[model samples]
Target: MILINRLRTVLAVTAVIVAPSGGTVLAAPSVPAPVSAAAQPTAPITLRYEANRRSMLAAGIDRPDGDFLLFDPNGRGRVAQVFGDLSTARRIAVLVPGMTNRLANFWRGVGGKSYRSPAVQAADLQRAGAGSGGFAVIAWLGYDTPQGFDEAGRANLARAGAAELERFVAGLVAVRPRATIALLGHSYGSVVIGHAAPRLPPQVTDIAVFGSAGMGVDDVAGLGTGARVWAGQSDQDWVRWVPAARLFGLGHGAKPAGPGFGARVFATADVHDHDHYLSPGTDSLAALARIAGDLP
Candidate 1:
């Protein structure tokens, strides 16, 4: 009986929400029963970067590796760190991680460098794109992320994180005005990016989501960003099993890589699992490098 109840809950949350009375939308039953994105307002929003900028900069932490400690709270684990030249870089890539990611686990040293880390992923992207032009990568750990299969696996975290992400992008653009920026969202980070998309800055040229659960919208058009949207998913990824629905805000809206998601499908060949999408020598890494570098 308990197992049956769980299955029923899953089915209920998986169904696309359709609120009658001119509010919610309904969808046809399919793998890609996408809900269209409602129009989002485009307005200039500001960021609060003053609190820690002076303190962090006076410490000279940014000079060594171009590390910009954008935000770090006293008692909290949320942080945003940038790698590479932010002052005059021609391009920048912002990496947003999924669940179980924090400043404490940002990097891991397996042998010499941690390929299993989001920080390393950013560093690898910086290396791949450096030849094309000046570039920087940001491992944005600016939200309170939920762990896998945790009770807090809902959209509230994403919705709040989305606002912070937009603010962070605004701060980045304020520093590097002409740089072409790309957002690389992995796993649940894609959900945050989707919520942030409509309000993203004009300098952002691309938004790429990989191993996403869903992007809180049906298709790329729903994102409401002028930036080109890209999606990639490995066949073996377990996130593919997560039902795509917005009912009760229990899950993200639609699968970005599913049929009719309307994102530019990129190849994820040679990427074995979910954690190593940015691992070196993989097609997924190469494609992300190209996007970050703004290469043809």
Candidate 2:
């Protein structure tokens, strides 16, 4: 029975990779060029935020509920919303989401659930770290994310996202040279972080992933980053059932939260499922906040 289940899992994952629509194979989209480091230092963070906000307004896009440092409505859409004043922040956290996210549901979430909304999750993290002082959080939807299980089973989208994420962090580091930064990713976002890790700047002090299937690597050393690595997975997460194996570029590889992956494991007992890791008052959120705020 166990062997039959394992085989079914493999076949199902393979089907997604080869023919996500059940009849047609889809080609990966072209990755955009990384943001140039030269362009970032030209403007302060505040100026950038205002300029993007103005652009969004002019484009007739509805006003964002909070400050946005970056916004583009083209294609699958991209945005980076800030939770606090970036200019005065000494510590910053960038939260990356997983599959099925786009501008259409960036604010309200997939089904209007606060826990799944990137903006709400960032706000929650910001509030969790409010006492830490000089802290800010950015809900970063800077890449074209995979829309379903078919794309999620592959690494092409993740590679493209990694390039974009690397550049976004570079811009942040350029603007706030002295600020400590943390990268937090959930689910397939963790795969993006795994690919971006080796290229990220030293100012990024930590990387945390929750409810992850894998980071597209064998272990922390495979990430090739000097920053500390953290992982969390609730027993209730369905991702635990995903095969932690990489085959023919199909799976994402070993789970980061599992033993032997070399990440500092954190408790997620309060998290009820994959989407609840960043929910308010969860132990996972508190731990992530501490990492982002540079608290012990």
Candidate 3:
């Protein structure tokens, strides 16, 4: 009951008792439950995205370029960086990058690299839909990506990273339950998504793999999610040469960009090499923006 009703009853009882005679007086009753939705946490879990953002900037662990959705201080640092307004967004785009990505370079693009950093890519995707209040692009470097090309040949990191990826998706769903989520996994990250696909929430509507070595699955149907699967390839991407076989656990199975991978090989113009899919004005980037915005 409301506190006012309880106080009124207490006053009535006190009037009939010795309270009027200066004997025993009743104390104010306590409130049972908080009335506002902001009570405790807004959701089942308190992501504290805003708190973490401020903390990272103050400590120099992150930059002022974008917001931090989730951040880990230990070691090389795992993070989820947001490029647009996530709380009010209708669509969400998650960018899971490939090898050699760490907290230090999460936003800083490396010099002479074949592709742009995850941060730049995410920003580009966000700007693509700025007219319609586009998706909240997230650069999720939440796993220990392989340090080099040689270490990337195996699927060990992807196998171990799958659980965390699934949890991250669940957390996003908790915060934006009605938002349409799209997953974009580059290189070895594809294998991580492949393993996590079976357990992904229903809110996820699309999964795209580009410059992937392999997804560790024979076909898109094998991933077990209802989301549409897409693969983008460029003429210069060296990942095409990576063996599509997972024999003896040496590599991820079934190349996603290959002809028989069973994913939609959608429009990919200006495709240069591995990691160039996010280049501005590229067909792949445009298509990706559409997928995230749920636009045709």
Taking all chains together, each candidate's TM-score versus the true structure is 0.75, 0.85, 0.80
Worst 10 residues of 3 by lDDT: 32-41
lDDT by residue (1-296, candidate 3, tens digit) is 58878777666544332221112334445423222221112332223454454456655663645566666655766777788888888898898988888777776754535256888888888888555784788988888889887678777788778888887888778778888898999888788888889999989989998888888888887889999998887868887777778777688888877788788886765887777788888898888777766776
* Model 2 CA lDDT for position 28: 29
**Per-residue C-alpha lDDT of model 1 across residues 109-206, encoded as one tens digit per residue:** 22334775777788888888776558878888888777655523588888988998888787667657788899999988998999999999889999
User: Stretches of candidate 3 above 4 Å error?
Assistant: 1-47, 62-65, 111-115
lDDT of 2 at 129: 83
User: Per-residue alpha-carbon lDDT of model 2 for 52-111, expressed as tens digits?
Assistant: 665576667787355777777778888888998788899999999999899889989977
Candidates ranked, most accurate by TM-score first? 2, 3, 1
**What ordering of candidates by lDDT runs from best to worst?**
2, 3, 1
Clashes of each: 0, 0, 1
TM-score result, candidate 1:
0.75
Top model number, lDDT: 2
Q: lDDT of model 1 at residue 55?
A: 34
CA lDDT of each prediction against the hidden true structure: 0.72, 0.83, 0.74
Clashing pairs in 2: none
